[model samples]
Target: MIMSHPDSIPLNQVLPIFLQVLPLKEDYEESTAVYGCICNLVLSSNSHILSFVPQLVSVFAQVAVSPVESHEVKVHIGRAFSHLISIYGHQIQPLLGNLSPAHANALAAIAP
Candidate 1:
């Protein structure tokens, strides 16, 4: 229901695109397309995507730690994390308490 807003559409669509990239190791072109979309989501307005932060970080963390994920995908996730930290870290920190202190501390440091 909350995702029905026009402003949220771009952010809402990012997860599926990221999924497409995460599972496809051999398709550089396709992966790049999805990663670009994810980058857009990262930079999108937090008010539009505030509810989706946990989903975004969980997916990115899953991919970030996955050996099966492509290096390119991992790189996108890293960038996404940076964007999330810089843009929405305060909003996302509670959801990320499951992560180690060092990583959580780093994210907290980057958060507004």
Candidate 2:
């Protein structure tokens, strides 16, 4: 059941609208607001609804490269990873292997 999580589309399908509001210089607070929504989804175990953590980790990687993503947005992603590692420390190993040094380094910092 855990492995089948990424087949879910509503999660990815919903993010672009929030992403689009950026490149055009929209409200600064919007990204954090949307991030909070995603955070709620995560804390409630909806994050576990993914096929694997790697796919969601990829989304964070994308945000790292996103020019329109604010520093706050990037921080939001980092915080989300921190939350994940707190409850699911074992899952970070594969995700760290897949991420770039910069991103992987941040994950390391979250380790207990």
Candidate 3:
């Protein structure tokens, strides 16, 4: 649905839902899927996502640095960061310093 017409998806509605759910530790698999969905949505609709970059980046950083987060989840988070950086490196560059050491390392590993 989002892929077909990314702009049509109501980010204001969906993002709040994702932000509430994605940080929970109880549903790792579901959270991973949600992260993937977010990555795809941003890739498909960069312009629309630009407005929420700070929030998205913060969530990704949190997930990437979480000590108890699953390896699979971390992989997805890394990929998401890599894609975001690839698409918006200039805008996101300054925010990199704000990330935790672990999160910065994960991003550096996958970033070009």
Candidate 4:
């Protein structure tokens, strides 16, 4: 819904829902969907989603390094992460700096 009709759906409401589902251990498919939505939001150039970037970064870092997650999930996160870096590299660097060494390294390994 967000990807197809971003104007009809307010991000403030949808983002909270995404944040809640993204960290679950039992739902890689749903988490992958969320990452896809986030990647779409980033590519769409929606400035409203910018405020949620920090939280997304944290979650993306966690998911990227999770041993139980599927390789497909990591690829989705990598897409989102790459979009984030290309568009928000300056802001993202500091946030990445705040991640644990393992998390930061995982993200770096996926960087394009």
TM-score of each: 0.55, 0.54, 0.72, 0.83
Provide the lowest-lDDT 10-residue window in model 4.
27-36
Name the lDDT of candidate 1.
Answer: 0.57
- Where's the lowest-lDDT run of ten residues in candidate 1? 1-10
lDDT digits (tens) for residues 1-112 of candidate 4: 8888888987877777767766667856676676677867866767777768888788888887888877876787777788888888798989999999999999777655
Kindly report which residue pairs in candidate 1 clash with one another. Answer: none
Q: Which ranges of candidate 3 are over 4 A from the true structure?
A: 1-8, 110-112
lDDT at residue 12 of model 2 (Cα atoms): 55
Instruction: Report RMSD for candidate 1.
Output: 6.4
For residues 1-112, write the lDDT of model 2, one tens digit per residue: 1123434556556554534443224564566666555545565556433333565565666556666777766776777766677767887677778878876664444323
Model 1, 16-83: lDDT tens digits are: 45454453456555655565555455666445444566766665665555455567666666776777
Error of 4 at 40 (Å): 1.6
lDDT (CA) per prediction: 0.57, 0.57, 0.70, 0.78
Question: lDDT ranking from best to worst?
Answer: 4, 3, 2, 1
lDDT tens readout by residue for model 3, 1-112: 6556666888667767666655657766566566667777666655666567777787777776667777776676677677777777788877877887787776666433
Clashing pairs in 4: none
Question: What global local distance difference test value does model 4 have?
Answer: 0.78
For model 1, what is the alpha-carbon lDDT of residue 90? 76
